[model samples]
Target: MASESDGQGRLPTGIPWSSPTVRVVLLSTVLAPLGVPLISPALPTIRDVLALTDAQASLLVDRVGRRRVLIPSLFAFSLLGAAVALGPPYWVVLAVRVVQGTAAAALFITTVTLIGDTFEGVRRNTVLGVNVAVLSAGAAVYPLVGGALAAVSWNAPFAVYLVGLPVAVLAYRVLPEPAGERERRSVSYLRNVVSALPAREAAALYGSAFLIELLLFGAALTAVPFLLDGTYDLPAVLIGAVVTLTEVASVVTSALNGGFSRRVSNHGIIAAGFGIVGGGLVAAWWAPTLGVLVAATAALGAGWGTVLPSLDAGVSEGVETRFRAGALSFRNSTTFLGRALGPWLFTTLVVGRGYRPLLLVAGGCALAFVPVVLLLGRRG
Candidate 1:
C-alpha cells in the first residue's frame, strides 16, 4: 500500500479552496446539517400555511430512519428537496421530509467515507477538521438563511434543499470509489473487518461520538432553546444569536484541531472536549442571565469542535483501508442516532424533574466518558 507521506506528499493537488476534492467534500458536509436546521425558522409559517399539527410540522427535518442506506438515500434526498419546495399536501410533505432524513444520512456517511478514502495521516486529520468546521459553519448559517427566506415565503427555505443537486454532481465527479469497495460490502468481509479492529478502543471512540452529539443536539441545541424561551423570555433574534455564537466557537476550535492533535494525544483531546462540554452544560444549568448562557454555549461548541475531528482521526487510524468506509458509516450512524435520540431522551428525562436536572444529566454524561477515554488512550 502507498504510504500517506510517500513522494506524493500529504496535500492533494490544487490550492485548498480551489481544489475539486476539497470543494466537493466540504460541500457534501453542508448537505446533512443543512437539512437539520434550515427548516427550523420556517416551522411556524409552515404550520400556519399548511394547516399542520405540531407533530406534522416537526417531521420536516426529523432525523428518524435515515441510517445505512447509502446511494439510494442521496437520490431520495435530492428528490425530496425538490418535492418539499412545491408545498404539497401536509401528508405528502411529511412523507417527503421523513425520506429526506434518510438522504441526509446517506450524504453524511458518504462524505466521511470519501474523506477517509481520499486522504491519509495528518492530511486526513486536517481535512476531517475542515469538514467538521464547515459542518458547524453550515449549522450556524442555516437558521439565519431560513429566517430570511421565511420572511419572504415559507416555501423559500425548502428551496435550500436544491443545493443538494449541485453537491451531488460535484461528489460524483470528484469522489473516487474506494479501492476494495466490492469486498467491503460482503457480510463475511465486514465481519472480518470488525473482528480485526481493536474492539474496546473502537467502542470508546464510537461511544464518545454518540455522547458528544447527544450533548450537542439534545442538550445544547434542543434544550437551550426552551431555556431561552421559557426562562429568559428572550426574543427569537436573541436566541438565534446565541446559537450562532456557539457555532462560531465550534468553527474556531475545529480550525485549530490539526494543531491541537499535534500537541496532545487523541485521548487527551477527547477528554478535554468532554470536560469543557460538561462544564459548559453545568454552567448553563446554573446561569442566571443571557451572558452566562452565551459563554456556556461557546464552551459547549468548543468541546464539540475538539471532539469530532479527534474521534474521526482516531477511528480512521484504527481501521484498515478496506473496512474504512464501513467503520466511518457506523460512526456516522451513531451520530445520526444521537441526534435523533437526544431531544426525545432529554425531553423525556426532563419531564417532572425540569431542565436544570436534565442539563446536569447531560453534563454528567459527558464527564463520565472522560475516564473511559483516558483509559483507552493509555491502552492505545
Candidate 2:
C-alpha cells in the first residue's frame, strides 16, 4: 500500500548510482529501438539469404503489434532472437519478427510508463529527454554493430537481440507493478484510460507522435536505404554510418531538449520540428550527391529529435499517474504502427510515381502537422 510518491522518493540520487529503477528504465529504452535499426544495416543481406523481395525484407521492420501481453512478449522476444540467430528458414524468421515487433512495443510503453510513475515536474521532463536520448544513442550504435557483424554473417545481427535477455532480467527485478486504486483487466483499464484522457490535448500529442514516426521511421529509415542502395550501391557498413549521422543529430537535439523547453513553447517547438523535417525531406529527395543526403538526414534528425521529447514531456505531464502506462502504451503503439505502415505505404507510392514524388508527399505530411500542433498550443 505504497503511494506513487513513496516510490519516487525512494529513487537514488548520486555517487555510484544504485537505483535499479533508473538502471532498468534506461536499459529498457535501449532495447526499444533495437528491433528496427539493429538489423537495418544488414537488411539487403537478409533479403538475399532468405530469397526475400524488398517488400518481404521491409516487413521484418514493420510488423510491430499488440500491447496487453507485454511481459510474455519480452520473453518471446528473447526466444525469437535466438531462433532468428540460429538462421531459421525465411517463413520462421518472419513469424519470429512479428512477435519481436510486439515485444518492442511492450518494452517501449513499459519504459515510458515507469518514468511517468517514478518522477514528476522538471525531473520527469529531464528523464524523458534522457530516455529519448538513450533511444537515439541506441539507434546510432546498433546499425554500426549490425553492419560489422553482417561482415561476418547476416545471423550475427540477430545475435545482438540477445541483449534483450539481460534487459528482461533487470526489468523483472526493478520495475514495480502499476498500483491503481483498483485492479482492472487490460481492456477495461485501456478503455478507462482513454475515457479519462483530455481529448483535445491527447489528440494533438498523440497525433504529433504518430506523424513524427510517419516521417522518421516511415520516410527516412524506410526510404533512405533503397535510395542509397539503388543509387549509390553503398555497402551496409557505410549505410550504417550515414544512418548513424542522422541518429547523432537526434542525440544532440534530445540531450539539449530540456533547455529548449525552457526557451520555447511546446507547440512552437513541435511546429518548427515539422517544418524542418519537411524541408529536410525535400532536400533529401532532390539531393544529387551523398554529401547532400547526409546534410538532409542531419536536418531530418534535428527536426524529429525536437518533436519526440516535446511530445513525451507534454503527454507525461498531462496524464494522470494511474492512466500513464495505458496512455503511453497507446502512444508507443502509434509509433510502431507508423513504422509498420511507412515502408508499405511509401513503397507502393514509389512504384507508381517514384522516390522524388514520394519524398514530396512525406515532407508535405510532416508540414501538415504544424498548424494542428499550433492550435493545440493555443488551446493550452
Candidate 3:
C-alpha cells in the first residue's frame, strides 16, 4: 500500500477545511441545529394540538443505542417523524422527537469526529472554532423561521428535517474520509469502539458543555415566546423578533468569542463560560421586565459562545488522530444526551413550579458541574 504520507509524514490534500471542505461539512452542522430552534417558537401550538405536557415538549440531544447507530441515527429519526406525522397523532409526533434527538446526537458527534480525524495543527483549532460558530449560527436563525412558519401551521417545522438527506449525500461526495493513523490502529470493529472512549470522554464533555449551554439557552428560547406572549402580552411576531434579537446577540458573541479564544487559555475561557451561563440563568429567572429578559438572553448567548469553542478545541486537541471521528461521535452522543435530558428535566419541573423555578433549577445545575469540571482537570 502506498503511504499517504510521502514517507515524510504529510497529507496529500493539504488538510480538512482546506478550501471547499468547510462548506460541505458545515451543511450537516447547519442542518442538525436548525430543527429545534425553528420548532421552539412554535412549541406551544404543538403542545396544545398534541395535548402534551410541558416536560414532553422541549428540545434536547441523546444517543442512538440501536441500528448502525452512528451517522444514520442523525437522519433516521427525522424520517420516522415524517412517517408518523402522516397519522397526525400527538403521541407519535412526540415519540418522533425522541428519535430525532438520537439522530441529532449522531450528526453532531459524527461531524466533530470527522473533523478531529481530518486535520492537525492550526487547522484543527481553527476548524473547531468555526464549527462551534456555525452551529450557533444555525441555532440563532432557526427560531425566527420556526415562529414565522408557525403563522402558517404547527407541523411546518418538521420540514427542516427533509433537508438532511441531501446534506448527507453532500457529505458522501465532498467530505474527505482521511485515514492517516486510524487505518493502521485496528482491524477490528469492537476494538475501534473501545479505542474511542478516553478521547471521546473529553470530546463528550466539550460537547456536553455545548449542549448544556444549548439546554439552558434552549429552555430560555423555547420559553421566551410563551413568556412574552403569555406574561407580557406581546404578539407572536414580536416574540419572534425578540428571539431574533437573542440570536443576533448569540451569533455576535460566537464570532467575538472565537477570536478571543485564540488569544486565551482554553481552561480559563471554559470556566468563565460556565460561570456566565450559570449567572445568566439566575438573572433571567429573576428578571422583572422584558428588557431584563432580553439582557439575560444576550448574557446566556455570550456565555455559550465562550464555553463551546473552548470545549470544542479542548476535545479536538485531546483526541487521538485516527479515532477522532468515532470519539467525536461518542462526544456528540453525550452532548445530545445532556440536551435531551435538559428539556425533559426543565419542562417536567416547570410544570409544577413555573418558569422562574425552572431557571433557578438550571442555574443550580450549571453551578453544580463546576466542581465536577475542576475535579476532571485535577485528575491524571
What is the alpha-carbon lDDT for the whole of candidate 3? 0.62
Our tally of clashes for model 1 stands at 0
What's model 1's overall lDDT?
0.77
Using TM-score as the measure, the top candidate is 1
RMSD of 3: 6.1
Clashing pairs in 3: 60-339, 61-336, 61-339, 61-340, 62-336, 73-103, 74-103, 113-325
> What are the RMSD figures for all models against the true structure?
3.3, 4.4, 6.1
What ranking of all candidate models by TM-score puts the best one first?
1, 2, 3
Lowest lDDT sum, 10 consecutive residues, model 2, at: 10-19
Can you tell me which runs of candidate 2 are displaced by over 4 Å? Answer: 1-18, 43-59, 65-74, 87-91, 186-188, 222-240, 285-290, 350-354, 357-361
lDDT per residue (tens digit) for residues 1-380 in model 3: 11255567753322344444566567777877754666777778777767777666653221242112333754584576456435467666666777776667666766666555555444555566677778877876887677787677777766667777765565556555454533543457437755544643463365456556455545656655566776789976777667666556556555554456546556656666777777877887898988988787667767766666566656666655655555555555555566556656665667757787777777776666665565555535
lDDT tens digits by residue: candidate 1, 209-247? 888888898887888888888988989888888878889
lDDT of 3 at 83: 62
Off by over 4 Å in 3: 1-18, 39-104, 146-170, 180-219, 222-236, 286-288, 347-375, 378-380
Q: Alpha carbon lDDT of residue 31, candidate 1?
A: 73
